[model samples]
Target: MTDVLVLTERELRAAVSLDLDAVDVVERAFAGLGAGGVVMPPILSMAIEERHAEVDVKTAYVPGLDGFAIKVSPGFFDNPKRGLPSLNGMMIVLSAETGIVQAALLDNGYLTDVRTAAAGAVAARHLAPATVRRAGVLGAGLQAELQIRALALVRTVPEVLVWARDPAKARAYTERMAASLSIPVRVADSPEAVVRGCDVVVTTTPSRTPLIEAGWLHPGLHVTAMGSDAPDKNELAPAVLARADRFVCDRRSQSAVLGELRSAIATGAVPEDWPVDELGEIVAGTKPGRRSADEITVCDLTGTGVQDTAIATHALRVARASGAGHVVEN
Candidate 1:
């Protein structure tokens, strides 16, 4: 018989919040990835164009981990019109040796939010300038708020700029984050303003067209573009890659197909044989990051399955230690 820990969203939240610990867990996973021998497959994505929704399946196996995880994440862009949230999903963990179910983390995308935001923090930690007084975000949704919070853990942020197509959402996000993060969060007049006004910028929107242009990139700027996890979505113009002094991808292979890199490659901005550095390689120190303070660095993160497995494993361990979930025997 095997015992499976079943955790609800609240229980998992009690176990794993979006903190520096979460950032370290994802960072370690990246280190393992950079060291090699980690088996992370391509993302399985299904887009229902009719409803403006997508379902993504991602999974991975790290060499030293006791269990691997498979995560199913769905985003229904129109859900907000229905007065519901857009993102919701869960993860399942299986033992590395026996292939038995270890836990059912019914987090409803909470873990994904944390891990994704943590990846942003990791990007800022290694790539952003030494001092970041102002941070800028392109979206006013969950990820925008979390990314700022995560960046604060790595850098001191006294001010933040946010821009969304919907002015109401941007204003609401500004007010809420200002009160919560104890920092000034203001609504930017435009995407250009957000990019130009801050040293570090994160784009979290679902825009099909480019929200950021190449001309806005400045010296000592760090941009983390995480919104384009699909073939049809893009946030940064292809030339943005050309303008960047240093470009980093979460996974070169995956980014070449599904992330912003693909768009850049298609438009002839970045060569097919450009030879870029993966975030893992930089994290592992096998590759360099931001050689000089004047370099404009960009990180393309499509999100990886190793991160899912890593965070799921970490959350499960914490849940057990804190007695947060119910165990089911099968």
Candidate 2:
């Protein structure tokens, strides 16, 4: 039997903190895909609609890591009334070699948030201008906070601007994240303000409409669109995508179906020949990220199975070392 490494949300957090190696693991997973050593199957998801809310069950298999992660997250409607997170989920990691049970992670959506945010950081590290000094985030939800923390790990950002529909929540998030990271956080009045001034902009909303406009983005700015991971979800305007010098994604197949590229493609704003390269291509030196300092770059990430496997594997290693998970005899 494979040693199952069950990890809790707290343990996952501790694991990410204690190890910079987790980032490397995730990076290599992408690089492996670019080098043709990995196979990331399409994500299969189903939505259960309710009168009050809906829940989504998603499964993805990553062949490079020889594992898969299954997740279930609920809609945002019941958050206030239930005193629970709008998103609720867990990931079950399995051994790819034998398809045996390996570990179950009760991350409560925390691991997903971190792994997705880490993807943004990876994108920024590759695509952002070398002189990047300021960052902006659109959306003040759970993922937004983690994006700030993750981006801090890569660039020397001294100031970060946050914008949310709710002024109070934005302020609170700014205060809390700023205190924790020792960086200056500012609250922006509009999404345009956040995109206009920052060298790196991250969008983590659940909006189906465009939040960042094309005109607001300056030359050399790097935008990470982490909001739209599913069909009918979009954050960046089609015009913004059309203006980018480089439009990169975690996976071309998924992004063509669900990411902002989907909207761009549907509107005919982006040409059929437009090459939407994968981040792995850049990591593998198969393609260059930023052609020039003034190139406008966009990294559209829909979260990949490879990322889940990397995080789950790292969490397992950490849990084993820290004696955090329980073992069972079967």
Candidate 3:
């Protein structure tokens, strides 16, 4: 009989928080990827255009880890109108030694959320300015709040500026975030306001068109574009990438197909062979990051399979140690 542990979202949440430790695990995974110690497959994505939904499957095997994770994520943009969350999914952990099923994490996409946010923190830690006074967020959704929380771990951000398509949503986000972060949060009238007012800007919207223009980029501004994980989505103009002093992405190949890098390359703003650095290379110390205080930096994060494996491994470890999940025999 084989025993498999089943962890629910609540139990997983109790075991893991989006803190520095979580960020470290994700950072290590990226470093492993850069060092060629991880085996990650191309993401398998399918679109359900009729429902405005897309599902992605991601997996990676780290050489030294005992287990790997296969994550299935579904995003239905129209779910909110039906009183359902726009995102939901689960992760399956498999033993590296025998490829046996080790655990099933029914996290309801919580682990994905935390790991993606942690990646943002890792990016800011390596690419953002040493001291950040204010940060801006482009979307007033779950990621908008999580990205700021993650950024606080790397830099001292005392204030926030948020902009959303709906002014009411932006105001609500401001009030809620102000209470949560213990910092003043203000609503911005436009995307340009958010970009011009803050030192670090995070774009978290699933915007099809460019929300940030090239002209808005200035010296010392760090932008983390985390929203464009699909081919049909983009948040920054191609010219914005051309203006960056340092352009980095979580992975070059994935970014070319699904991230903002695709749009830049498509528009001829950046060459297909441009020496764009990966966040992993920077984290592994093989490449330089933020060489000057006045340099404009941008990191395009499309999320990765290695991040899923890392977070799932950590969550399972923590859950087992804390006795938070149920075990079943089959």
Native-vs-model 2 lDDT? 0.80
Best by lDDT: 3
Model 2 TM-score relative to the real fold? 0.92
How many residue pairs clash in all the candidates, one count each? 0, 0, 0
The best candidate in terms of TM-score: 3
Q: Between 2 and 3, whose TM-score is larger?
A: 3
What TM-scores do the predictions have? 0.97, 0.92, 0.98
Residue-wise lDDT of candidate 1 within 1-330, one digit each (tens)? 889999999999999988889999999999899989999988888989999998999999998999999999999999999999988999999999988999999999999999999999998899999888789999998899999999999999989999999999999998889889987888999999999999999999988999999999999999999988878889999999989998898999888887889989999998988888899998899998778889999999999998999899999989999888889998
Backbone clashes in model 1, listed as residue pairs: none
Q: Report RMSD (Å) for each prediction in the order shown.
A: 1.3, 2.2, 1.1
Order by TM-score, highest first = 3, 1, 2
What candidate 3 gets wrong by more than 4 Å, as runs, is none
lDDT tens digits by residue: candidate 2, 260-315: 99989889989866777899899888999788989999999988877777777777
Q: List the residue pairs that clash in candidate 3.
A: none
